[model samples]
Target: MKFDSVIMGGGLAGLVAGISLQQAGKSTAIVSMGQNSLHFFSGSFESMTEPPQRVADLFKDAGIGLHYRQGVRLMPLGTFRESAMSLEDIELFPSEKFARRVLIVNFQGYHDFFSSFLAEGLEKKGMRCRIRLINIPDIDPTHQGPGEMRSVQIARTMDRIWEKVVQEIRLLLKDEDAVILPQVFGLQDISVPGRIRQALPAKVVFVGTMPPSVPGVRTQMLLKKRYQLLGGTYLMGDEAIKAHVHEGVVHSVVTRNLDSHYLEASNFILATGGLFSKGLVSNPFQLYEPVFGLDVEFAEDRNTWYNPAFKEDQPYMGYGVKADDTLHAIIDGKPLENLYAIGSILGATHPELGSGAGLAINSALVAVDQILSEK
Candidate 1:
C-alpha cells in the first residue's frame, strides 16, 4: 500500500501529525502497535508552558476538545501540581465552580484512590473537603485476587452501580460545596460525569486514577475517530518494523504483520515514544534509534543515566533521536530528506519540564509543516 505520508506510532504525536497531514490533503497512514500512550494519561495535559494560539488551534481542528485552565492537580499524596489543560470532565484545582465544603468519595476496597490523600492536598491548597468511602461488599473490585483495584475495570462496571453511587453521594452530601469522585466513569463515556453532576445538586469532580485511564482512552478514541472522519488510514495492531531507507529518503516501511507488503510513502514520521515505549533501544554499550537506525543523543555513561532522587532531574529523560531545525530525522550525521522525528522521540524533550503534550502537538504540527513545505 502507498500513501503520501506514513506515521509510525499512533500515540498523541503520531495521531496529531497524521490528522494534520490528512487535513492538508495528504493521504496519510498511521501504523501503530495496539493502544497508544494516552492509556497512561491522567485525563489532564501536563505542561509547565502553554503553547501559542496556533498550536492550540491544531487540537481544535482535530476535534479533540480541551479546557485550557490556569490551575493545578491536587495529588492524593498531598501536593499541588500545576496543570495547563484538561478534559471538560476533569476538575482543576481551586475551581470557583465548587463551594468551600466538598465531599470526596472512594470505594471501600479500591486502593487506587484514597480520599484522605487528595483531601490532604486540597487542605494544603486551602480547600476544605470531607472524605467518604462507599462500600462495595457484594462485588470484588480487585483485579487479581485481593490485589489493588484497577480503574479500568471499575470504570467498565461503574454504570451498573451508577444509581447506587448517586444515591450514596446524595446521602453523604449535606450542603457540601461539591462532590469529588475517583475517575471510575465508564471507559468511553465522557458524559458519565455530566450525568452524575446533573443528578446531584452540587458540583461533581473526577480525579484521575492509575491507567488505563477512562478519560485517556476516551481521548484516544475521540482523536482516532476524528482521524478516520478526515480519511486518515489507521493500521492498528501493527507496527513498522523495518524502514526501507535509501538515497537519504525512506522508501517504505514493513511491519511485522505485513512482512512483504510495504507501506510505501513519500514522507515518514517517527513519533514512537522514547525508551519506556521502546522507540529508542539500548544495550550495555550504547543507545540507538530502533527504526531506521537514526542518530540519537543520550548519555554514554550508564552510571550517570539516572539520579538517586525520584523527583530530581534524571539525565536519561533528555535522550532521544536527534533532529534538525526542520524536524528531519538524522542518520549518520546527515538529515533524512523524507523522514521526520517528532514528540517524545525527538531529543531535548524533557517530560520533567511538564510540557510533554504541548511539545508533542507542536512538534507534530512542525513536522507536518515541513512535509507540506517540502511538497
Candidate 2:
C-alpha cells in the first residue's frame, strides 16, 4: 500500500501526526504495535513551558473539550503541580489554593485509590476533607477481590451503576466545596463530572485511577475516532519489523502482520516511544532504535544513565534518537531527508514537570509541519 507518509507507532505522537497530515490533505497511515501511553495517562497535559496554542486547540476541536488553565493539576496522590492544560473534569485548580472543604468519594474496595494517601496531600494544602465510600456489586461480579478492579473495569460497568453512584454521592454531599471522585465515568463520558456537579452544589472533579483509566482510554479512543473521521488509515495491532531504507531515505516498511505486503510511503516517522515503551531499546552498554535503526543520542557511559536516588530525574529519560534542526532522524550521522522522528522516541525532552504530554504533542505538530513542507 502507498501513502503520503507512513508513521511507525500509534501512540499520541503518531495519532497527532496522522491527524494533522490528513487535515493537510496528505494520505497518512499509522502502524501501531499496541496500546499508546494514553492508557496510563495521568489526566493532565503537562509541560515545563507553556504549551503551543495548537495543542489546546487540537483537543478542543477534537471534541475532548480543552481548558487552557496553565495552573496546578491534581496528582494521583492529591498534590497539585502546574500543567499547561487538563481534562475538562479533572480535579484541578487555577492556582495552588484549593477548596478548603471537599468531599472525596471512594468506590468500596477500589485499590487504585488510597483515601488516606490522597488526604495527606490535601491536608498539606490545608484543606478539610471527608471520605465517602459507596459499594457497586457490578464491578466485581464473580465475588473476587475488588482490589484488582482497575479504572477501565469500573468504566465497563459504569453505565449500570451510574445512577446509583450519583444518588449515593448525593446523600453524602453536605457543606463541601468540591467532590473528588475516581475517574471511573463512562469510557467516553466527559459529562459525568458536570452532571454530578449539577446534582450537588459542590464542584465535581475526577482523579485518575490505575492504567487504562476511563479518562485516558476515553481520550485515546476519541482522538483515534477523530483520526478515522479525517480519513487516516490506522494499522492497529500491527508493528513495523523491517524498513526498506535505500541510501538516505526509507521507501517502505514491512510489518509483522503484513510481512509479505510492503507498506510504502514517500516519508516515514519513527515514534515508537522510548526504552520503557520499547521504541528505543538497549543492549549491553548501547541503545538502539528498534525500527530503522536510526542513530540515537545518549550518555557514553551507562553509569550516568540513572541517578542513584530513585526520586531524582534519571538521565535515561532524556536519551533518544538523534535528530537535526528539522526533527529529521539521523542515520549513520547523516539526516534522513524523508524520515522524521518525534515524541518520546525522539527523547531528550527532559521535561521540568508532569508526563511531558505537551512535549509529545508539540513534537508531533512540528513533525507534521516538516512532512507537509517537503517536495
Clash counts per candidate, in order, are 2, 0
Name the candidate that leads on TM-score.
2
Write one digit per residue (lDDT tens) for candidate 2, span 266-338.
9898889888679999977899987788888888898988999998888888888888877888989999879
The collision pairs in model 2 are: none
For model 2, the local distance difference test gives: 0.79
Worst 10 residues of 1 by lDDT: 347-356
- Model 1 clash number: 2
Cα lDDT, all candidates: 0.78, 0.79
Q: What TM-score does each of the candidates earn?
A: 0.89, 0.93
Best lDDT goes to which candidate? Answer: 2
lDDT for position 259 in model 1: 88
